[model samples]
Target: MAARPVSGAGAIRVGIGGWTFEPWRGTFYPDKWPHKRELEYASRQLTAIEVNGTYYSGFKPETFAGWAKVAPDDFVFALKASRFCTNRKVLADAGESIARFTGQGIVELGDKLGPILWQFMATKKFDAVDFAAFLKLLPASQDGVRLRHAVQVRHESFAVPEFVALCRDAGVAIVYAQSDDYPAIADISGDLVYARLETAVEDEPAGYSPVELDRWADAARVWAAGGQPDGLASVSDPAPVMPRDTFVFMISGAKVRNPAAAQALIARL
Candidate 1:
């Protein structure tokens, strides 16, 4: 099962946060499926995956290469940047931590590597100067592999037009988080759109209802075709009409049904 590519527009990738989850074992995966083969199976089902483990731990080049070999050629892995790089008071001083995280064999993923997500703490406030400096620290490429960066700011202070402008200037995507606790910024600030849909419920078999899934599918297409959706909150006007790759991940909420939600959205697309 290779990833399905959309024609005429930028690719719209649908996926879950990560492949490994105990709850997914009979729900999303086969009852007798081997635990070690979960990535191989999940990669075939979803077009992309948000790798959360990299946020907490570092892996060897071989570990990353091994993952690349298992997944489909068109399948991509969006890695969460290390907490050490974004969890500090002075974000401008995190160049060393950022370098360390980027240099940690991530280029081994090669073309399979998607965007690197830099998620800030909920308590962190928006600082224009510091944030701008921090964004400038991100490398344009690593070992010949071009890298895409997206920031997930949890605080409401980041909901302003200034923040959107900063990300636009830096060419880094602003993650549109659909969590009640996080500020949802729908403004298009980068070349790509990264969305984390967190409003899933255990009552629904697919985490989200069919109507919601349909809505998301429509939104994904709009984003891929370079236009903002009508309903989401946006601090700025719609971005210019141009194709942009879109990454939509079913995350948080009823975590158990996320895989189903991702698959459902993929099916709709």
Candidate 2:
């Protein structure tokens, strides 16, 4: 469970959506292992974790500090921005909510903080002007610690070139979601790559076939090196080649097998 070494210019981290799950009690965690130490065990097995709970509830500064203390030095926690920020009827008016969420002592995570994911509902359509305004609300740093942001748009309207241009101009990553339900935008808009792989199957021991795992591993390398992988859908031209840190999380589809899937992908990397 030691930190996995990275050899390239940009690091590629693979992980699951969150650390806590009742199904993982025996399958992922050692049988009868202390429930309180789940994050400690999970942090060592994977390089990152997308904190889904933060999307619904806020945590105290001490809670964030506690997480940072338990996690490994190289481990990262990608926070899902609160629902109040992205689920509003008018995204332009979310400044107060955004401020509230960012000001909630997230900086306590320190180096353990990764990207903040702003996810919109599928019903939310793309409004170039309004969306641009929302992106502007995202701060470059919080409490002297630099912050990275990524947006996950589920509507197909977001797959247009203008959307990609907006994110590119703001330097916010457009999460490359690999799923049949969401529009997969593979364009690289920022210096970092954030991906959520949602195609895991319950039948597969690793949640994905070995072939699929290999494919994702290859794609991760390509993304880390700042090159587009072959066959992914894109609305914009290829981005200039430059190294970028990559974060890939196994989420949704077969939730039970996600930890295994994340570990498998990490091994392949």
Cα RMSD (angstroms) for every candidate in the order listed: 1.3, 1.5
lDDT of 2 by residue, 1-269 (tens): 32223455478888898888999999999999899999999998999999999999999999999999999888889999999999998899999999899999999999889999999998999999999999999999988899999999999989899999999999999999999787889999888999999989999999999999999988888888778999999999887888888999999999999999999999988
lDDT of 1 by residue, 176-209 (tens): 9999776798999789999999989999999999
Residue 22 of candidate 2: its Cα lDDT?
96
lDDT of each structure? 0.92, 0.91
* TM-scores, all models, native as reference: 0.97, 0.97
Candidate 1 stretches greater than 4 Å from native = 1-7
TM-score of 1: 0.97
- Runs in model 2 with CA error above 4 Å? 1-8
The candidate that wins on lDDT is: 1
Candidate 1 clashes: the total is: 0
